[model samples]
Structures are given as structure tokens and as C-alpha cells.
Target chain A: EDKVVQSPLSLVVHEGDTVTLNCSYEVTNFRSLLWYKQEKKAPTFLFMLTSSGIEKKSGRLSSILDKKELSSILNITATQTGDSAIYLCAVDPSSNTGNQFYFGTGTSLTVIP
Target chain B: EPEVTQTPSHQVTQMGQEVILRCVPISNHLYFYWYRQILGQKVEFLVSFYNNEISEKSEIFDDQFSVERPDGSNFTLKIRSTKLEDSAMYFCASSALPQGYRQPQHFGDGTRLSIL
Candidate 1:
């Protein structure tokens, strides 16, 4: 079975702290890895990483995928309370699998003001 | 921006009752999906629909689960008989293009289903 695991199921940090969330996966025919931020409502798109070494960034948030290690990391710099949410990672298969996505349990980050 | 929309932000039903979750995907989106996340659990994929037909479904999609695009604009997931375990937040998603196009699926706010 395809599997994705995240570390430190829950974390609490104060404002201005830089946090790193890790996600590791084991799957056949890797295609792409995606990050999502889920708050009280739904999971919103973050970054989708398909290449190794190249980092994708959006403002204070950045992510990179390591295909060699079969893992990815999401980094948030100078975090704010609004950054608090459950971060999810998903892996997609390369073969035509009808776009069936596999998701991780997610890391809950609490950014305290 | 175009967004996927779901009806009845919250639905409460008794076990053995039938329930239908409705969604309206982005007008130009051709691919649709249904997913659910139980409290404190990972969101799971239930089914994916394209061209008015189901392209794929997960093991969680059993006999009691069915999906349909009743109209050009509406997609629905019907649960024949609700179970306590079925209580979760059902999310509807859609992508404007086909898979492998590098377009991420956009999700709705989700419908919280509570089975008593």
C-alpha cells in the first residue's frame, strides 16, 4: 500500500519562529508531491513539488522535495497565528491511476500570538 | 476566481437513513472527486468522476455509495444507508483540466455529516 507519514503530529510555537514540517512517503511510480493547509473548513492548496532540489516558495512559506530520500519538507519563516493549521502532504502515482491521491495524517501546527 | 461549492454545510441524520451530498464544480472543470475526513483522520478519496462517468473509486466506496452528475452543473454523492462510522466532513473537488496536467484539485468548504 502507498504510505505517507509526517513527524511531530502536533507542534506549538510562538510568533516569528521558523518551523519545518516533514513528510515521507513510500509508493510505486512516484509522480508528484503536494502540500495543503487545512484550517476549520477545508484543505487549501499550498505547494506541489515534482522536482528534487528545486524549492518552491510563496512569501514566507517554502517547500522542497527529495526524490532520492522519498520525502519532502515544508518550511514556514516568521510564522504568524494565521499560519496555524493542519498541514497535509499527498503523493500521486505516475501511472494512469485516475488521479487517485494518497494523503498523510498531517501535522498540526499551532502558532501562538 | 471559480470555486467548487457544496450544499448544506452541515447535515444530521439517523443511522440507516439515506443522505445525498450535492456539489457544483467549477463551470469549466471536467474532473470531479469526492473525499471524506473523519475527525482526526486523513482525508480519504471516495470517487472520481469525469465525462459524466466514474473513472475511479477507492475501497471505501462500497455498495451503499453512489455518485452521479445529475445535470451539467451538479454532482452528487448518495449514501444509501448511513452508518455511525460515516460521520465525517465530505469534500468535493474539481480540476479544470485532465490528470497529468499539473493542475491541483480545488476543494469546497465541505459538508459535515453527523449520523446519530
Candidate 2:
């Protein structure tokens, strides 16, 4: 069965702390991996990683994919109260059936001031 | 800076009643998708539509659920008979057509469906 799993179901960190969230998956055909931040309502797009080794970065957040290991990690530096939200990891698999996205349960991060 | 939009932020319905959740995907997007997240649960994909047809659907999208692109701008998901288990936050998402790579999906605020 194809599934995506995220580690550290929940995390607590102080402001200015650095944290790393992990995502691992097992699928038939891997296309890409994406990260999202869900605050109160909708989930906003964060990062999308498709290749291995190379890192994708934006401001204080960065992510990388390891295709050989079938895993990915999201790193957040200079964490703030605003960064406290459920971080979701999703994997898109190329299939003859259709285009679908499989999501992890998400890592709930609480940054305390 | 276009985003997907959903109607009726919240809806309350009795079990066995029919309900239609509507969404207007980004104007230039070609791929549309529907997902649901039950309270305290992870988000789950329900279906994917492209070219006015369902290209993929999960097991949860069974006979009770159906999706339609009634017009150029509107995509709707209809529940034939709502059940208590159907209560969830339904999210509509869309993405531009992939050109050699996958495009990231953008989601709406979501419609909160409550079944009594």
C-alpha cells in the first residue's frame, strides 16, 4: 500500500529555535513531494521538492528530497509564533490510473514565545 | 494572485439529506481536486478531475459521492445521502497543467459540513 508518514507527530519549540520535520513515503511511481502550512482555515503552499540532493529554500524555510531513501525533510530556522501550525507533507505519484496526492498526518508545531 | 474559492463556509444538514459543495478553481488552472479533512484527522484526497472528467478517485469517493463541472467556472461535489461520517471540512484545490513536471496545488479555505 502507498502511504506517507511524518515523524514527531507534535513538536514544541521556543521562539528562535530551529526545527526539522521529517516525511517518508512508499509509493509506486514518485513524481514530487510538497509541503504545506495549515494555520486556521486553508493550507498555504510552502515548498515542492522533486529531485534528490538539491535543496529548495525560501526565507527561513528549506526542504530537500532523498529519492534513494524515499524520504524528505523540512527545516525551519528562526521559528516564531507565526510559524506555529500543522505542517503537512504530501507526495504526488505518477500513475496510469490518475493524478493523486497522498498526504501525511502532519506535524503539529507549537512555537512558544 | 488567484486562489480557489468555495461557497457556504459552513453547512448544517440532517442525515440522509442531499448537499452540493461548490468551488471555483483558479481561472487558469486545468487540474481540479477535492479533499476532505475530518476533525482532528489528516487530509484525504477524494477525487481529481481534468478535462471535465474524473481522472482519479479514492475509495472514499464511492457511490454516495459524485463530482461535476457543470460550467466553465464551477466544479461541484454532490453527496447523494449525507451520513454522520460525511461531516468534514471539504477543500477544493486546483493546479496548472504540468509541463514536464508536477505543479503545486492551491487550496481554498474549505467548506465545513456538519451532518446531524
Over the true interface residues, superposed, what is the Cα RMSD of model 1? 1.1
lDDT (Cα, 0-100) at B24 in candidate 1 = 95
Candidate 1: which docking quality band? medium
Cα lDDT tens digits for candidate 1, A7-112: 8799999999999999999997888999999999878999988989999999999999999999999999999999999999988877655787889999999999
What local lDDT does model 1 show for residue A94? 73
Local distance difference test values of all predictions, in order: 0.93, 0.93
DockQ scores of the candidates: 0.73, 0.70
Candidate 1, residues B1-116, lDDT tens digits: the string is 88889999999999999999999999999999999999989999999998888989999999999999998999999999999999999999998775577888889999999999
What are the clashing pairs of model 1?
A: none
Q: Across residues A6-89, which tens digit of lDDT does each residue of candidate 2 receive? A: 999999999999999999999988888899999998999998888899999999999999999999999999999999999999
| DockQ versus reference, model 1 | 0.73
lDDT of 2 by residue, B1-116 (tens): 89999998999999999999999999999989999999999999999899989988999999999999999999999999999999999999998875235678999999999999
Q: If scored against the real structure, what TM-score would every candidate get?
A: 0.98, 0.97
